[model samples]
Target: MTESPRPSEGRSGGAQPAADLARIVVFAAFTAVLGTFPGIYLAGAAVPIVLQNTGPLLAGSLLGARRGAASVLLLLVLVALGLPLLSGGRGGIAPFFGPSGGFLVGWIASALVVGLIVSAARRPTLAVLLPANLAGIAVDYLFGVPFMAQAIGDLRAAGVASLGYLPGDLAKIVLVSLVAAAVHRAFPNSLPRRKAAAKA
Candidate 1:
Protein backbone atom coordinates (compact mmCIF):
# COMPACT_ATOMS: atom_id res chain seq x y z
CA MET A 1 0.00 0.00 0.00
CA THR A 2 1.13 3.54 -0.68
CA GLU A 3 1.97 5.46 2.47
CA SER A 4 0.62 8.93 3.16
CA PRO A 5 2.93 11.93 3.08
CA ARG A 6 4.16 13.11 6.46
CA PRO A 7 1.97 15.67 8.21
CA SER A 8 4.84 18.14 8.40
CA GLU A 9 5.44 17.92 4.67
CA GLY A 10 1.77 18.35 3.86
CA ARG A 11 1.44 21.36 6.14
CA SER A 12 4.57 23.04 4.90
CA GLY A 13 3.31 23.43 1.37
CA GLY A 14 -0.08 24.70 2.44
CA ALA A 15 1.30 27.10 5.03
CA GLN A 16 3.76 28.86 2.79
CA PRO A 17 1.26 30.77 0.71
CA ALA A 18 -0.72 31.83 3.76
CA ALA A 19 2.42 33.00 5.51
CA ASP A 20 3.46 34.97 2.48
CA LEU A 21 0.09 36.64 2.23
CA ALA A 22 0.09 37.50 5.91
CA ARG A 23 3.53 39.04 5.70
CA ILE A 24 2.52 41.12 2.73
CA VAL A 25 -0.53 42.42 4.53
CA VAL A 26 1.40 43.09 7.72
CA PHE A 27 4.14 45.09 6.02
CA ALA A 28 1.65 47.09 4.01
CA ALA A 29 -0.19 47.96 7.18
CA PHE A 30 3.10 48.67 8.91
CA THR A 31 3.88 51.27 6.25
CA ALA A 32 0.49 52.85 6.68
CA VAL A 33 1.02 53.03 10.43
CA LEU A 34 4.37 54.75 9.95
CA GLY A 35 2.60 57.40 7.94
CA THR A 36 0.52 58.21 11.01
CA PHE A 37 3.60 59.77 12.51
CA PRO A 38 3.72 63.46 11.71
CA GLY A 39 6.10 64.50 8.97
CA ILE A 40 8.94 66.97 9.50
CA TYR A 41 9.09 69.86 7.09
CA LEU A 42 12.45 71.49 6.56
CA ALA A 43 12.73 75.26 6.47
CA GLY A 44 11.30 76.56 3.17
CA ALA A 45 11.00 73.04 1.81
CA ALA A 46 7.91 71.79 0.02
CA VAL A 47 8.31 68.13 0.87
CA PRO A 48 8.39 66.83 4.43
CA ILE A 49 10.85 64.38 5.87
CA VAL A 50 8.75 61.33 6.73
CA LEU A 51 9.38 58.11 8.61
CA GLN A 52 7.18 56.23 6.15
CA ASN A 53 10.20 55.92 3.89
CA THR A 54 11.72 53.38 6.25
CA GLY A 55 8.87 50.98 5.62
CA PRO A 56 10.24 49.98 2.23
CA LEU A 57 13.72 49.46 3.60
CA LEU A 58 12.48 47.25 6.37
CA ALA A 59 10.02 45.38 4.18
CA GLY A 60 12.62 44.60 1.53
CA SER A 61 15.26 43.57 4.03
CA LEU A 62 12.86 41.33 5.88
CA LEU A 63 10.49 40.08 3.21
CA GLY A 64 12.74 39.84 0.13
CA ALA A 65 12.06 41.22 -3.37
CA ARG A 66 8.65 40.12 -4.58
CA ARG A 67 6.84 40.37 -1.29
CA GLY A 68 8.52 43.64 -0.34
CA ALA A 69 7.56 45.33 -3.58
CA ALA A 70 4.07 43.91 -3.28
CA SER A 71 3.71 45.43 0.17
CA VAL A 72 4.64 48.90 -1.05
CA LEU A 73 2.42 48.55 -4.10
CA LEU A 74 -0.50 47.53 -1.91
CA LEU A 75 -0.13 50.65 0.19
CA LEU A 76 0.12 52.83 -2.90
CA VAL A 77 -3.03 51.30 -4.29
CA LEU A 78 -4.90 52.22 -1.14
CA VAL A 79 -3.48 55.71 -1.32
CA ALA A 80 -4.61 55.95 -4.90
CA LEU A 81 -8.11 54.94 -3.81
CA GLY A 82 -8.19 58.16 -1.74
CA LEU A 83 -7.37 56.65 1.61
CA PRO A 84 -5.54 59.07 3.93
CA LEU A 85 -2.70 56.61 4.20
CA LEU A 86 0.22 58.91 3.71
CA SER A 87 1.98 60.97 6.33
CA GLY A 88 -0.05 63.85 7.73
CA GLY A 89 -3.13 62.08 6.37
CA ARG A 90 -2.29 62.98 2.79
CA GLY A 91 -3.42 60.60 0.04
CA GLY A 92 -5.17 60.14 -3.32
CA ILE A 93 -3.79 60.77 -6.81
CA ALA A 94 -2.85 64.28 -5.79
CA PRO A 95 0.26 63.19 -3.89
CA PHE A 96 1.34 61.22 -6.89
CA PHE A 97 1.27 64.43 -8.94
CA GLY A 98 2.95 66.55 -6.28
CA PRO A 99 6.60 67.21 -5.52
CA SER A 100 6.89 63.98 -3.52
CA GLY A 101 5.45 61.91 -6.36
CA GLY A 102 8.70 60.54 -7.68
CA PHE A 103 9.75 59.37 -4.26
CA LEU A 104 6.44 57.61 -3.90
CA VAL A 105 6.89 55.94 -7.24
CA GLY A 106 10.50 55.05 -6.44
CA TRP A 107 9.54 53.18 -3.30
CA ILE A 108 8.62 50.04 -5.27
CA ALA A 109 11.97 50.03 -7.06
CA SER A 110 13.86 50.80 -3.88
CA ALA A 111 12.33 47.84 -2.10
CA LEU A 112 13.04 45.61 -5.07
CA VAL A 113 16.71 46.59 -5.09
CA VAL A 114 17.11 46.22 -1.36
CA GLY A 115 15.55 42.76 -1.37
CA LEU A 116 17.68 41.64 -4.28
CA ILE A 117 20.86 42.70 -2.47
CA VAL A 118 19.98 41.25 0.89
CA SER A 119 18.73 37.96 -0.54
CA ALA A 120 22.06 37.45 -2.25
CA ALA A 121 23.51 36.66 1.16
CA ARG A 122 23.12 33.26 2.80
CA ARG A 123 22.16 35.09 5.92
CA PRO A 124 21.20 38.69 6.39
CA THR A 125 23.65 40.41 8.71
CA LEU A 126 24.15 44.00 9.77
CA ALA A 127 26.91 44.56 7.23
CA VAL A 128 24.82 43.14 4.40
CA LEU A 129 21.68 44.96 5.47
CA LEU A 130 23.38 48.34 5.95
CA PRO A 131 24.55 48.58 2.37
CA ALA A 132 21.30 47.14 1.11
CA ASN A 133 19.31 49.77 2.97
CA LEU A 134 21.62 52.56 1.81
CA ALA A 135 21.20 51.48 -1.77
CA GLY A 136 17.44 51.63 -1.30
CA ILE A 137 17.77 55.17 0.01
CA ALA A 138 19.83 56.12 -3.02
CA VAL A 139 17.13 54.77 -5.32
CA ASP A 140 14.58 56.89 -3.52
CA TYR A 141 16.65 60.07 -3.85
CA LEU A 142 17.37 59.36 -7.49
CA PHE A 143 13.69 59.57 -8.33
CA GLY A 144 12.79 62.24 -5.80
CA VAL A 145 15.42 64.81 -6.74
CA PRO A 146 14.47 65.16 -10.36
CA PHE A 147 10.78 65.45 -9.53
CA MET A 148 11.46 68.06 -6.89
CA ALA A 149 13.63 69.97 -9.34
CA GLN A 150 10.84 70.09 -11.86
CA ALA A 151 8.28 71.06 -9.26
CA ILE A 152 10.38 73.89 -7.88
CA GLY A 153 11.72 75.08 -11.24
CA ASP A 154 15.30 74.83 -9.88
CA LEU A 155 17.33 71.71 -10.53
CA ARG A 156 20.36 72.97 -8.61
CA ALA A 157 18.29 74.00 -5.63
CA ALA A 158 16.39 70.72 -5.60
CA GLY A 159 19.66 68.79 -5.43
CA VAL A 160 20.84 70.96 -2.58
CA ALA A 161 17.53 70.74 -0.79
CA SER A 162 17.64 66.95 -0.85
CA LEU A 163 20.77 67.17 1.24
CA GLY A 164 18.59 67.96 4.22
CA TYR A 165 17.27 64.41 4.13
CA LEU A 166 20.73 62.92 4.63
CA PRO A 167 20.98 63.08 8.39
CA GLY A 168 17.60 61.51 8.99
CA ASP A 169 18.04 58.92 6.25
CA LEU A 170 21.40 57.85 7.62
CA ALA A 171 19.88 57.37 11.00
CA LYS A 172 17.13 55.26 9.49
CA ILE A 173 19.62 53.08 7.64
CA VAL A 174 21.43 52.31 10.86
CA LEU A 175 18.21 51.61 12.71
CA VAL A 176 16.75 49.41 9.99
CA SER A 177 19.97 47.48 9.55
CA LEU A 178 20.13 46.67 13.21
CA VAL A 179 16.49 45.67 13.38
CA ALA A 180 16.63 43.54 10.26
CA ALA A 181 19.78 41.82 11.36
CA ALA A 182 18.26 41.01 14.74
CA VAL A 183 15.09 39.68 13.15
CA HIS A 184 17.00 37.47 10.76
CA ARG A 185 18.98 36.08 13.66
CA ALA A 186 15.82 35.21 15.52
CA PHE A 187 14.23 33.74 12.39
CA PRO A 188 16.75 32.42 9.93
CA ASN A 189 14.13 31.72 7.28
CA SER A 190 12.73 35.25 7.29
CA LEU A 191 14.78 36.20 4.22
CA PRO A 192 14.51 34.55 0.86
CA ARG A 193 17.11 31.98 -0.17
CA ARG A 194 19.59 33.09 -2.79
CA LYS A 195 19.12 31.55 -6.20
CA ALA A 196 21.68 28.99 -7.34
CA ALA A 197 23.75 29.73 -10.43
CA ALA A 198 22.64 27.81 -13.49
CA LYS A 199 24.91 25.23 -15.06
CA ALA A 200 26.63 26.22 -18.27
Candidate 2:
Protein backbone atom coordinates (compact mmCIF):
# COMPACT_ATOMS: atom_id res chain seq x y z
CA MET A 1 0.00 0.00 0.00
CA THR A 2 1.16 3.51 -0.66
CA GLU A 3 1.78 5.69 2.35
CA SER A 4 0.22 9.12 2.82
CA PRO A 5 2.58 12.05 2.79
CA ARG A 6 3.44 14.04 5.92
CA PRO A 7 1.59 17.15 7.04
CA SER A 8 3.78 19.56 5.10
CA GLU A 9 3.97 17.50 1.96
CA GLY A 10 2.37 18.01 -1.49
CA ARG A 11 0.97 21.51 -2.00
CA SER A 12 3.24 23.26 0.50
CA GLY A 13 5.79 20.47 0.68
CA GLY A 14 8.89 22.42 -0.25
CA ALA A 15 7.84 25.72 1.32
CA GLN A 16 9.89 27.00 4.19
CA PRO A 17 8.02 28.34 7.18
CA ALA A 18 10.33 31.32 7.32
CA ALA A 19 9.78 31.98 3.64
CA ASP A 20 6.06 32.13 4.21
CA LEU A 21 6.56 34.65 6.99
CA ALA A 22 8.92 36.65 4.84
CA ARG A 23 6.52 36.71 1.94
CA ILE A 24 3.84 38.10 4.25
CA VAL A 25 6.11 40.75 5.72
CA VAL A 26 7.64 41.76 2.42
CA PHE A 27 4.30 42.23 0.72
CA ALA A 28 2.96 44.18 3.68
CA ALA A 29 5.95 46.49 3.63
CA PHE A 30 5.77 46.85 -0.13
CA THR A 31 2.16 47.95 0.06
CA ALA A 32 3.00 50.49 2.76
CA VAL A 33 5.92 51.82 0.76
CA LEU A 34 3.81 52.21 -2.35
CA GLY A 35 1.31 54.21 -0.33
CA THR A 36 3.94 56.91 0.02
CA PHE A 37 3.66 57.90 -3.62
CA PRO A 38 2.18 61.37 -3.92
CA GLY A 39 -1.53 61.51 -4.63
CA ILE A 40 -3.67 64.02 -6.51
CA TYR A 41 -6.09 65.81 -4.29
CA LEU A 42 -9.20 66.92 -6.08
CA ALA A 43 -10.42 70.49 -5.75
CA GLY A 44 -13.24 69.68 -3.33
CA ALA A 45 -12.85 66.02 -2.49
CA ALA A 46 -11.97 64.67 0.93
CA VAL A 47 -9.75 61.87 -0.38
CA PRO A 48 -6.96 62.06 -2.90
CA ILE A 49 -6.47 59.93 -6.00
CA VAL A 50 -3.47 57.71 -5.38
CA LEU A 51 -1.76 54.69 -6.84
CA GLN A 52 -1.99 53.10 -3.43
CA ASN A 53 -4.22 50.43 -4.90
CA THR A 54 -1.30 49.07 -6.89
CA GLY A 55 0.28 47.29 -3.96
CA PRO A 56 -2.79 45.30 -3.02
CA LEU A 57 -3.45 44.54 -6.65
CA LEU A 58 0.02 43.14 -7.10
CA ALA A 59 -0.15 41.33 -3.81
CA GLY A 60 -3.42 39.69 -4.70
CA SER A 61 -2.23 38.57 -8.12
CA LEU A 62 1.16 37.40 -6.95
CA LEU A 63 0.54 35.99 -3.51
CA GLY A 64 -2.83 34.24 -3.75
CA ALA A 65 -5.87 34.49 -1.46
CA ARG A 66 -4.92 33.92 2.18
CA ARG A 67 -1.45 35.34 1.86
CA GLY A 68 -2.68 38.42 0.01
CA ALA A 69 -5.29 39.18 2.63
CA ALA A 70 -2.76 38.59 5.38
CA SER A 71 -0.33 41.06 3.89
CA VAL A 72 -2.95 43.77 3.68
CA LEU A 73 -4.10 43.03 7.21
CA LEU A 74 -0.60 43.36 8.58
CA LEU A 75 -0.15 46.73 6.93
CA LEU A 76 -3.48 47.89 8.27
CA VAL A 77 -2.47 46.85 11.77
CA LEU A 78 0.63 48.97 11.51
CA VAL A 79 -1.41 51.90 10.35
CA ALA A 80 -3.79 51.39 13.23
CA LEU A 81 -0.80 51.41 15.56
CA GLY A 82 -0.06 54.97 14.45
CA LEU A 83 2.45 54.35 11.72
CA PRO A 84 2.26 56.84 8.87
CA LEU A 85 1.96 54.12 6.27
CA LEU A 86 -0.89 55.23 4.02
CA SER A 87 -0.84 57.61 1.06
CA GLY A 88 0.66 61.00 1.97
CA GLY A 89 1.68 59.36 5.24
CA ARG A 90 -1.89 59.27 6.47
CA GLY A 91 -2.38 56.51 9.02
CA GLY A 92 -3.50 55.67 12.53
CA ILE A 93 -7.01 55.14 13.90
CA ALA A 94 -8.14 58.45 12.54
CA PRO A 95 -8.35 57.33 8.94
CA PHE A 96 -10.41 54.32 9.93
CA PHE A 97 -13.09 56.67 11.22
CA GLY A 98 -13.08 59.06 8.28
CA PRO A 99 -15.14 59.04 5.11
CA SER A 100 -12.55 56.86 3.43
CA GLY A 101 -12.89 54.25 6.13
CA GLY A 102 -15.06 51.89 4.18
CA PHE A 103 -12.67 51.78 1.28
CA LEU A 104 -9.90 50.91 3.67
CA VAL A 105 -12.06 48.22 5.14
CA GLY A 106 -12.66 46.86 1.70
CA TRP A 107 -8.95 46.56 0.94
CA ILE A 108 -8.30 43.40 2.86
CA ALA A 109 -11.50 41.78 1.69
CA SER A 110 -10.96 42.75 -1.92
CA ALA A 111 -7.42 41.44 -1.89
CA LEU A 112 -8.71 38.06 -0.77
CA VAL A 113 -11.39 38.07 -3.41
CA VAL A 114 -9.02 39.20 -6.12
CA GLY A 115 -6.38 36.70 -5.15
CA LEU A 116 -8.90 33.89 -5.33
CA ILE A 117 -9.98 34.88 -8.80
CA VAL A 118 -6.54 35.66 -10.14
CA SER A 119 -4.92 32.56 -8.79
CA ALA A 120 -7.74 30.28 -9.81
CA ALA A 121 -7.69 31.45 -13.39
CA ARG A 122 -6.21 28.91 -15.81
CA ARG A 123 -4.64 31.71 -17.81
CA PRO A 124 -4.41 35.43 -17.25
CA THR A 125 -6.30 36.55 -20.32
CA LEU A 126 -8.49 39.63 -20.58
CA ALA A 127 -11.50 37.49 -19.75
CA VAL A 128 -9.94 36.80 -16.40
CA LEU A 129 -7.93 39.97 -15.76
CA LEU A 130 -10.58 42.52 -16.62
CA PRO A 131 -13.23 40.91 -14.49
CA ALA A 132 -10.93 40.19 -11.57
CA ASN A 133 -9.69 43.74 -11.26
CA LEU A 134 -13.03 45.37 -11.82
CA ALA A 135 -14.73 43.00 -9.44
CA GLY A 136 -12.15 43.77 -6.79
CA ILE A 137 -12.64 47.49 -7.28
CA ALA A 138 -16.38 47.04 -7.07
CA VAL A 139 -15.97 45.25 -3.76
CA ASP A 140 -13.95 48.15 -2.46
CA TYR A 141 -16.61 50.58 -3.54
CA LEU A 142 -19.26 48.35 -2.08
CA PHE A 143 -17.97 49.05 1.40
CA GLY A 144 -16.49 52.45 0.60
CA VAL A 145 -19.45 54.21 -0.92
CA PRO A 146 -21.81 53.51 1.94
CA PHE A 147 -19.44 54.77 4.58
CA MET A 148 -18.62 57.81 2.51
CA ALA A 149 -22.25 58.64 2.06
CA GLN A 150 -22.97 58.25 5.73
CA ALA A 151 -20.01 60.34 6.77
CA ILE A 152 -21.02 63.18 4.47
CA GLY A 153 -24.75 62.67 5.06
CA ASP A 154 -25.37 62.57 1.32
CA LEU A 155 -25.26 59.45 -0.83
CA ARG A 156 -25.33 61.58 -3.98
CA ALA A 157 -22.22 63.47 -3.00
CA ALA A 158 -20.38 60.29 -2.11
CA GLY A 159 -21.35 58.67 -5.40
CA VAL A 160 -20.23 61.71 -7.35
CA ALA A 161 -16.92 61.94 -5.53
CA SER A 162 -16.23 58.28 -6.23
CA LEU A 163 -16.24 58.98 -9.95
CA GLY A 164 -12.79 60.45 -9.46
CA TYR A 165 -11.40 56.95 -8.97
CA LEU A 166 -12.59 55.71 -12.37
CA PRO A 167 -9.80 56.79 -14.68
CA GLY A 168 -7.03 55.94 -12.26
CA ASP A 169 -8.57 52.61 -11.35
CA LEU A 170 -9.07 51.74 -14.98
CA ALA A 171 -5.43 52.49 -15.60
CA LYS A 172 -4.46 50.35 -12.66
CA ILE A 173 -6.61 47.54 -13.99
CA VAL A 174 -4.81 47.56 -17.30
CA LEU A 175 -1.35 47.82 -15.83
CA VAL A 176 -1.86 45.19 -13.19
CA SER A 177 -3.38 42.80 -15.71
CA LEU A 178 -0.41 43.14 -18.00
CA VAL A 179 2.10 42.69 -15.22
CA ALA A 180 0.24 39.76 -13.69
CA ALA A 181 -0.10 38.00 -17.01
CA ALA A 182 3.60 38.23 -17.70
CA VAL A 183 4.53 37.09 -14.24
CA HIS A 184 2.04 34.26 -14.27
CA ARG A 185 3.45 32.94 -17.49
CA ALA A 186 7.13 33.25 -16.59
CA PHE A 187 6.78 31.85 -13.09
CA PRO A 188 3.70 29.71 -13.09
CA ASN A 189 4.40 28.49 -9.59
CA SER A 190 4.67 31.99 -8.15
CA LEU A 191 0.95 32.13 -7.48
CA PRO A 192 -1.70 29.53 -6.72
CA ARG A 193 -3.25 27.49 -9.52
CA ARG A 194 -6.79 27.01 -10.58
CA LYS A 195 -8.36 24.00 -8.92
CA ALA A 196 -9.83 21.31 -11.11
CA ALA A 197 -13.54 21.27 -11.21
CA ALA A 198 -14.97 18.52 -9.08
CA LYS A 199 -16.11 15.56 -11.08
CA ALA A 200 -19.52 14.10 -10.68
Candidate 3:
Protein backbone atom coordinates (compact mmCIF):
# COMPACT_ATOMS: atom_id res chain seq x y z
CA MET A 1 0.00 0.00 0.00
CA THR A 2 1.34 3.43 -1.02
CA GLU A 3 1.23 6.12 1.65
CA SER A 4 -0.10 9.53 0.90
CA PRO A 5 2.19 12.51 1.52
CA ARG A 6 1.64 14.60 4.65
CA PRO A 7 -0.23 17.93 4.55
CA SER A 8 3.14 19.67 4.78
CA GLU A 9 4.14 18.23 1.44
CA GLY A 10 3.45 19.39 -2.15
CA ARG A 11 1.81 22.83 -2.28
CA SER A 12 2.11 23.38 1.47
CA GLY A 13 5.57 21.93 1.74
CA GLY A 14 7.70 24.99 0.90
CA ALA A 15 5.45 27.70 2.26
CA GLN A 16 7.28 30.10 4.54
CA PRO A 17 4.88 32.52 6.18
CA ALA A 18 7.57 34.28 8.19
CA ALA A 19 9.80 34.81 5.18
CA ASP A 20 6.84 36.12 3.22
CA LEU A 21 6.01 38.65 5.93
CA ALA A 22 9.63 39.79 6.05
CA ARG A 23 9.68 40.27 2.31
CA ILE A 24 6.54 42.38 2.51
CA VAL A 25 8.14 44.59 5.17
CA VAL A 26 11.31 45.04 3.16
CA PHE A 27 9.40 45.86 -0.03
CA ALA A 28 7.20 48.31 1.84
CA ALA A 29 10.30 50.17 2.98
CA PHE A 30 11.62 50.18 -0.55
CA THR A 31 8.36 51.70 -1.80
CA ALA A 32 8.68 54.51 0.71
CA VAL A 33 12.26 55.20 -0.26
CA LEU A 34 11.38 55.35 -3.94
CA GLY A 35 8.83 58.07 -3.23
CA THR A 36 11.39 60.68 -2.23
CA PHE A 37 11.99 62.14 -5.67
CA PRO A 38 11.23 65.81 -6.24
CA GLY A 39 8.49 67.26 -8.43
CA ILE A 40 8.75 69.87 -11.15
CA TYR A 41 7.25 73.23 -10.41
CA LEU A 42 5.34 74.64 -13.36
CA ALA A 43 3.79 78.05 -13.96
CA GLY A 44 1.32 77.83 -11.10
CA ALA A 45 1.29 74.12 -10.26
CA ALA A 46 3.61 71.36 -9.20
CA VAL A 47 4.01 68.35 -11.44
CA PRO A 48 5.43 65.29 -9.84
CA ILE A 49 7.72 63.33 -12.17
CA VAL A 50 8.98 60.94 -9.62
CA LEU A 51 9.09 57.18 -9.79
CA GLN A 52 6.55 56.98 -6.98
CA ASN A 53 3.73 55.30 -8.87
CA THR A 54 6.16 52.83 -10.34
CA GLY A 55 7.01 51.55 -6.90
CA PRO A 56 3.39 50.97 -5.98
CA LEU A 57 2.60 49.38 -9.32
CA LEU A 58 5.57 47.11 -9.14
CA ALA A 59 4.76 46.26 -5.56
CA GLY A 60 1.23 45.31 -6.54
CA SER A 61 2.30 43.26 -9.52
CA LEU A 62 4.91 41.45 -7.45
CA LEU A 63 3.50 41.32 -3.92
CA GLY A 64 -0.18 40.48 -4.45
CA ALA A 65 -3.06 42.56 -3.07
CA ARG A 66 -2.74 42.56 0.72
CA ARG A 67 0.99 43.06 0.87
CA GLY A 68 0.87 45.58 -1.95
CA ALA A 69 -1.79 47.62 -0.19
CA ALA A 70 0.22 47.38 3.02
CA SER A 71 3.24 48.83 1.24
CA VAL A 72 1.30 51.84 -0.01
CA LEU A 73 -0.29 52.35 3.38
CA LEU A 74 3.06 52.35 5.11
CA LEU A 75 4.38 54.93 2.65
CA LEU A 76 1.33 57.11 3.16
CA VAL A 77 1.67 56.94 6.92
CA LEU A 78 5.27 58.05 6.73
CA VAL A 79 4.30 60.95 4.50
CA ALA A 80 1.56 62.04 6.88
CA LEU A 81 4.09 62.10 9.69
CA GLY A 82 6.19 64.66 7.80
CA LEU A 83 8.76 62.30 6.39
CA PRO A 84 9.25 64.44 3.26
CA LEU A 85 9.06 61.22 1.30
CA LEU A 86 6.78 62.35 -1.51
CA SER A 87 7.52 64.00 -4.81
CA GLY A 88 9.54 67.22 -4.47
CA GLY A 89 10.31 65.73 -1.10
CA ARG A 90 7.02 67.14 0.07
CA GLY A 91 5.42 65.52 3.08
CA GLY A 92 3.37 66.44 6.12
CA ILE A 93 -0.37 66.62 6.60
CA ALA A 94 -0.59 69.82 4.58
CA PRO A 95 -0.11 67.98 1.30
CA PHE A 96 -2.81 65.60 2.33
CA PHE A 97 -5.24 68.53 2.34
CA GLY A 98 -3.83 70.38 -0.60
CA PRO A 99 -4.91 70.31 -4.24
CA SER A 100 -3.03 67.07 -4.79
CA GLY A 101 -4.28 65.49 -1.59
CA GLY A 102 -6.94 63.45 -3.32
CA PHE A 103 -4.37 61.86 -5.57
CA LEU A 104 -2.21 61.04 -2.57
CA VAL A 105 -5.02 59.30 -0.78
CA GLY A 106 -6.10 57.54 -3.94
CA TRP A 107 -2.71 55.92 -4.43
CA ILE A 108 -3.48 53.28 -1.84
CA ALA A 109 -6.73 52.37 -3.52
CA SER A 110 -5.05 52.37 -6.88
CA ALA A 111 -2.39 49.95 -5.72
CA LEU A 112 -5.04 47.71 -4.26
CA VAL A 113 -6.97 47.69 -7.50
CA VAL A 114 -3.88 47.06 -9.57
CA GLY A 115 -2.72 44.23 -7.37
CA LEU A 116 -6.16 42.70 -7.27
CA ILE A 117 -6.52 42.80 -11.03
CA VAL A 118 -3.06 41.42 -11.57
CA SER A 119 -3.75 38.55 -9.25
CA ALA A 120 -7.24 37.81 -10.51
CA ALA A 121 -6.46 37.99 -14.21
CA ARG A 122 -4.05 35.03 -14.18
CA ARG A 123 -2.29 35.92 -17.41
CA PRO A 124 -0.18 39.08 -17.26
CA THR A 125 0.07 39.55 -20.97
CA LEU A 126 -0.12 42.82 -22.90
CA ALA A 127 -3.90 42.68 -23.03
CA VAL A 128 -4.03 42.45 -19.28
CA LEU A 129 -1.44 45.18 -18.75
CA LEU A 130 -3.52 47.82 -20.51
CA PRO A 131 -6.61 47.23 -18.44
CA ALA A 132 -4.64 46.87 -15.20
CA ASN A 133 -2.73 50.09 -15.66
CA LEU A 134 -5.78 51.93 -16.87
CA ALA A 135 -7.78 50.81 -13.86
CA GLY A 136 -5.00 51.88 -11.53
CA ILE A 137 -4.62 55.25 -13.21
CA ALA A 138 -8.36 55.76 -13.24
CA VAL A 139 -8.47 55.14 -9.53
CA ASP A 140 -5.91 57.87 -9.03
CA TYR A 141 -7.89 60.36 -11.11
CA LEU A 142 -11.15 59.50 -9.40
CA PHE A 143 -9.70 60.71 -6.12
CA GLY A 144 -7.62 63.53 -7.58
CA VAL A 145 -10.28 65.33 -9.64
CA PRO A 146 -12.81 65.63 -6.88
CA PHE A 147 -10.24 66.85 -4.37
CA MET A 148 -8.80 69.38 -6.79
CA ALA A 149 -12.30 70.61 -7.55
CA GLN A 150 -12.97 71.12 -3.87
CA ALA A 151 -9.67 72.82 -3.24
CA ILE A 152 -10.31 75.42 -5.94
CA GLY A 153 -14.12 75.31 -5.74
CA ASP A 154 -14.22 75.58 -9.52
CA LEU A 155 -14.95 72.47 -11.54
CA ARG A 156 -13.68 73.86 -14.82
CA ALA A 157 -10.54 75.20 -13.25
CA ALA A 158 -9.81 71.89 -11.65
CA GLY A 159 -10.38 70.00 -14.89
CA VAL A 160 -8.15 72.35 -16.83
CA ALA A 161 -5.43 72.08 -14.26
CA SER A 162 -5.67 68.32 -14.35
CA LEU A 163 -5.28 68.38 -18.11
CA GLY A 164 -1.75 69.65 -17.67
CA TYR A 165 -0.91 66.37 -15.97
CA LEU A 166 -2.68 63.84 -18.18
CA PRO A 167 0.22 63.36 -20.56
CA GLY A 168 2.70 62.84 -17.79
CA ASP A 169 0.48 60.42 -15.93
CA LEU A 170 -0.09 58.42 -19.09
CA ALA A 171 3.63 58.25 -19.65
CA LYS A 172 4.11 57.04 -16.13
CA ILE A 173 1.53 54.32 -16.67
CA VAL A 174 3.30 53.16 -19.79
CA LEU A 175 6.59 52.99 -17.97
CA VAL A 176 4.99 51.16 -15.10
CA SER A 177 3.46 48.57 -17.41
CA LEU A 178 6.79 48.04 -19.09
CA VAL A 179 8.59 47.57 -15.82
CA ALA A 180 5.88 45.26 -14.54
CA ALA A 181 6.19 43.07 -17.60
CA ALA A 182 9.92 42.83 -17.18
CA VAL A 183 9.63 41.94 -13.54
CA HIS A 184 7.02 39.32 -14.35
CA ARG A 185 9.43 37.74 -16.78
CA ALA A 186 12.62 37.80 -14.73
CA PHE A 187 11.23 37.30 -11.25
CA PRO A 188 8.07 35.31 -11.80
CA ASN A 189 8.41 33.74 -8.37
CA SER A 190 8.50 37.10 -6.62
CA LEU A 191 4.73 37.45 -6.36
CA PRO A 192 2.54 35.03 -4.45
CA ARG A 193 0.26 33.07 -6.77
CA ARG A 194 -2.97 33.19 -4.86
CA LYS A 195 -5.26 33.32 -7.89
CA ALA A 196 -3.37 30.76 -9.89
CA ALA A 197 -3.14 28.36 -6.99
CA ALA A 198 -6.85 28.57 -6.35
CA LYS A 199 -7.71 27.95 -9.98
CA ALA A 200 -5.43 24.95 -10.00
Better of 1 and 3 by TM-score: 1
Tens digit of per-residue lDDT, candidate 1, span 109-168? 899899989877756888899999999999999999999899989999988878878888
Q: After aligning candidate 3 to the native by TM-score, how far in Å is the CA of 26 from where it should be?
A: 2.7
Give the TM-score (vs. native) of candidate 1. 0.83
Q: What is the C-alpha local distance difference test score of each model? A: 0.83, 0.77, 0.73
Models 1 onward score TM values of 0.83, 0.82, 0.81
Model 1 spans > 4 angstroms off: 1-15, 38-49, 194-200
For model 2, residues 142-178, the per-residue Cα lDDT tens digits are: 9899999999999999998888887778888888878
Tally clashes: model 3.
2
The global Cα lDDT (0 to 1) of model 3 is 0.73
Q: What TM-score quantifies how close candidate 3 is to the native fold?
A: 0.81
CA shift at 78, candidate 2, in angstroms?
Answer: 0.5
Rank all candidate structures by their lDDT, best first, as comma-separated numbers. 1, 2, 3
Off by over 4 Å in 3: 1-17, 37-48, 195-200
145-193 per-residue lDDT for model 3 (tens digits): 9999999998889899988888777887787788888878888766665
Which residue pairs clash in candidate 1? none
